[model samples]
Target: MHSLSKLFLTFVGFVGLSLASPGGGEDLPAVCDFAALRARWPKESCEALTSIQAGLPDLLRRVRPYTQTYVLVLLDRPDGVPRAWDDPVLSRLRVGLLADTPAETIAARYKFAQVVPYPLSPAGACALFADLHRGKIDAGLVWAPLAGYFVAVTDVENRLQALPVPQPLPPLEWPKSAWEGASASDSDLFRCADRIQGVLESYGVAPAELLTANVEESSVIPDQPPPEDLAAARVGEALYYRYCDRCHGTQAVLGRRGLELRQRFLQLSYPEFIRAIWEGRPGRGMPAYRGLLDKTQIEALYQYLRALTLGKIAPRQSTD
Candidate 1:
């Protein structure tokens, strides 16, 4: 009698699990309701997932079909040992454990093609994520630790959501001061906003509250709030690309003229990097761009140069 009962319970469990599979019983509507998923995951998890799954049918099909490829970018290098930055499993859906469905299988059903990984610096992550936000790729999978750091710095902090994964260890919580009181550098804010924007776009959240403000030249360095405002950063970038790119050559200044300038700053630390632009070395024929370039633009240039020095950006041949 005991054996028979045990067997019956086992059968029932199998049936339940089978019914929840991606294609077998009901489709579960592929998340027709975002709120329900939110209830299942943490606030951070919901934010990350919603942004990636915003345009469901297309994203599902793209990620699942052919290869089921999901692009993951780890800001830190893989030591093969799991660290706080390792969130690859949650980058997609909670699947199997959470919903009794596998993310890969769901992606397969949707026709996902491949899962690719790119290791990038914070700047590279920003550019790549920005491109993804613009629909250059399907979606970007990032580690939550870096994402949290970014959330505190960018304007998107209030606008975006951070999703928690299934069996999540514990959501990372940054000190409110990390994003509040201190004056965050422009590059820091830009990277933060880039992360927030990417997350927001993936979740299908509309950022109506976020506004783009024009950059204003200030004589004194005002005590700007933490996690610099991203909207203003972007505005400053647009202005820089339009006006300064022509003279200074923007991020990709090249030729013998450009090389000479880069060689000079190669040894300087980030602080010196800022100072050289602000105070100007003068003797090098490089004019002080401080007054003309706002704090945000200066950060962007610094980020670009830093990348170039690190060999992340290749300089073009000097025809002149």
Candidate 2:
């Protein structure tokens, strides 16, 4: 009877194990299946998912997804950037954070001499690094992809570094919903928000909140110029602000390394201007705008630059 009881206990344990297994008719939906998640969560939680998925390839491609945390640091010497986490002098330096960064969250993670708030957008990571390079700020926290792009373009990898923020590994938490049995979390949605936040933070010249501002759309250029030229220049100015102005500056004068177009306007003819922008100076960190900006937009940018260079239009002050 004792042996019979032992055998029955073993059988029950085996049945329990089988029922808990994935093949036991209790498998969870794949994490990538948004449709399954949508059915599980409310509609609004999934709204950000589409944009998140759309941008993931570009954002994730730039950094190791396995890296949990990062810190931006300035190299003491050109060769002083530390390769390992335990390297010395890391805690002694002053650090820069995005103006909108939840300082409380970061302060709890690491000790620094001080945390300086930089007014740039997160897309302005390069600009932030430029600040570091110029000694405007000591060190800054930046995303891996932005750091990678900065190093690639400026060839300044040795001059700066991003150290992994040393912390007890925290379990990756995803955005949770109130629905019953909705085990999946909205990690993608948070990542999407992070991407947008990064862009806003790096754009230091303007208020990060202005990204969502509901300003009435009007012609970028006044209605005084020839209608054709006015239309083209206006579109180009918008393109320039969106793509070019961060590094170039409001008047194209404050560019980190970009030529002050106002000063060099006479030296570059329209064709030369177009060629420079279209082809880009690759080794100098200028990306070719050919595929990104179409011929018409490029022309409009050229016209806008020309207008700015020739003193035909006053540079618009950043209201932020």
Off by over 4 Å in 2: 1-228
Residue 304 in model 2: lDDT = 84
lDDT against the true structure, each candidate: 0.34, 0.45
Candidate 2's error at 136, in angstroms? 22
The root-mean-square deviation over C-alpha atoms between each candidate and the true structure, in angstroms, is 20.7, 19.6
The number of the candidate with the highest TM-score is 2
Candidate 2 residue-wise lDDT at 22: 15
| Candidate 1 lDDT over residue span 1-320, tens digit each | 34323322332332342232223343222122233322433343223333332221222122111121122222211222111124343343221111112222333443223443322222223333433333334333443334332333331212223222212122222223212112234443334334433443332221212112233434444343224444554554554443333234444444223534456556665556655555444333333343335565666665555555566555434222
Q: 194-311 in candidate 2: lDDT tens per residue? A: 4433333232112212322343232232333233466677777887776676567788886655557667656765556666665555334444343244456667887787777767
Clashes of 1: 31
